[model samples]
Target: MYILGIETSCDETSIAIVKDGEEIIENLIFSQIETHKIFGGVVPEVASRLHMEVLNKIFKLAMEKSNLSLKDIDLISVTQGPGLVGALWIGITFAKTLAYALKKPLVGVNHLVGHIFANFLRKDPPNFPFISLVVSGGHTEWILVEDYDRYRLLGKTLDDAAGEAFDKVARLLGLGYPGGPAIEKAAEKGRLIFDFPKIKCERELDISFSGLKTSMLYLIKNLQKEGREIPINDLAFSFQYRVIEELLERSFIALNKFQTSTLVLAGGVVANKYLQKRFSEVSKRENIKLFMPPPILCTDNAAMIASAGYYLYNKGKVDGLDLSADPSLEIF
Candidate 1:
């Protein structure tokens, strides 16, 4: 079966054609990085407007690249929630119209679920009953995947997500947008000298990064007061170190508690090479299978939406004409 997916959950306007949720025929993503970089972050109004402008062209391109006509698609899926509402409405509206016109089933997918399924985009996919960590710009979560559509929420962030923390800290250091990559680059030239707080909560599963972000801010201010030049690289390294250490610590705990044999990492934060290396070492020593998508798939994309959609489609899940965007949509 062929699945057509559209994702405009945030700054990225993407579409994809997946065959049986296993093969990606074509995945087209139009990232607004350059446009949003100057602003140091994504502007919802600008993002929605940009999506309105380029969506149709992107649709045509996705169809053209996939070499498949609308009629050839068996179903249509669009990310419908847990994102900027305005940005999501554009894709949801377009997808609803397209599905109606094509006379195909339409499914609205949860954005976080889409991230977890991104693992399927890989060649050697991990088996079920795996520990899934989805750390992104907007969210940080741990899920126990029992099957394609069955999941159990293990833990999630209590405040800012890992990726969001990265961006905020990067901005404080005068780094550009997309903080994860910029911070990683700076850390490479420096060493972790400062000790940032390690997040801990009574509920071992819950995570926090807001305190870590504040610590960095205060650290910089104190340096300025001392008439000392702030070491941007060292600060970046220390900041990234604390963030990754928290993630690793929590992840290991979850793995042991859940008794899962595979660890599946998803979301934009996985793009950090340092994080990957740490996970790689753990995977080898702990003898746990590590499933991480290529960097391209690690970030937002429609293929992951399509992959998750395929599972929902099989479960007889369908949305009606009244379907609308749900920005606070929760994934269990």
Candidate 2:
């Protein structure tokens, strides 16, 4: 079956076509990083407008690249929730129009779960009952995946998501928008000199970053007041270290506690080199198989949605024309 997936969950406008969900025929993404960079964050209205402008163009390109026409598409899948409602509206509306005209099944995919399923596209797939760490701009979660469409949420962020903290901190430091890459780059030149607090939560799997973000703010302000030249790179390095430290600690604890042998990493933060390197180290020492998609699949894209669509469809999941966008949809 050929599934055409459209994703406008955030600042990215993407479209992709996949064959049976595993083989990506063609995936295309139009990034709004430059536009949002000026603002140092995403503006919902701007994102929705950009989606409207480029959605059709990319949709055409994806089809042309795949050498397939609308008639060849067997199913239409779209990210329906857990994103900007305006952005989600654009993709779901487009998918709905296509489904109506083509008389095909439309599947609504959970954006977060779609990340976990991205692993299926990789050659070295992990076995069932694996531990998945999905850290993103709006979400940070450690979930236990027992099988297809079966997710047991083990833990999640108590406050701001990891990606959100990165952006907020980067902005505070003038590191730039899309904080993950900016901070990561700056962190290279510096060392983890600052002793950022490592917060602990009552729940073993639960993690908190709100305090961490606040601590960085206090440190930066105090250094400025004291006339100490802020070591920007060093601060970035230390902050990144603290965030990743919390993530690894919680994830490793979960893995051992659950007795899961496979570790799967997903979401946009998975692209961070430092985090990935650290995860690689732990996976090696623990002798657990780890599945991480290439950067292309790591971030939000239509291919992952298509992969998820295929699985959701098989699970007898189908959306009606009445299906609408949901910004805060949860994965059950």
lDDT of each: 0.90, 0.91
For 1-332, candidate 2 gives per-residue lDDT tens digits of: 99998999999899989888788898898999899888778899999999999999999888888888889999999999899999999999999999999999999999998888788875556788999999989889999998878899999998889999999899889888888999999999999798887688999889888888888889989999999998999999999999998898888888899998888899999999999999899889989888888888989899999989998899889999999999999887
TM-score of each: 0.97, 0.97
Q: Cα RMSD (Å) between model 2 and the true structure?
A: 1.1
The residue-level lDDT of candidate 1 at 24 comes to: 93
Error of 1 at 60 (Å): 0.7
Worst 10 residues of 2 by lDDT: 117-126
User: Which residue runs does candidate 2 get wrong by more than 4 Å?
Assistant: none
The Cα error of candidate 1 at residue 144, in Å, is 1.1
With candidate 2 superimposed using the best TM-score fit, by how many Å does residue 12's alpha carbon deviate from the native?
A: 0.6
Could you give candidate 1's per-residue lDDT for residues 168-223 as a string of tens digits? 99999988788999999999998979988788776898998888888999999999
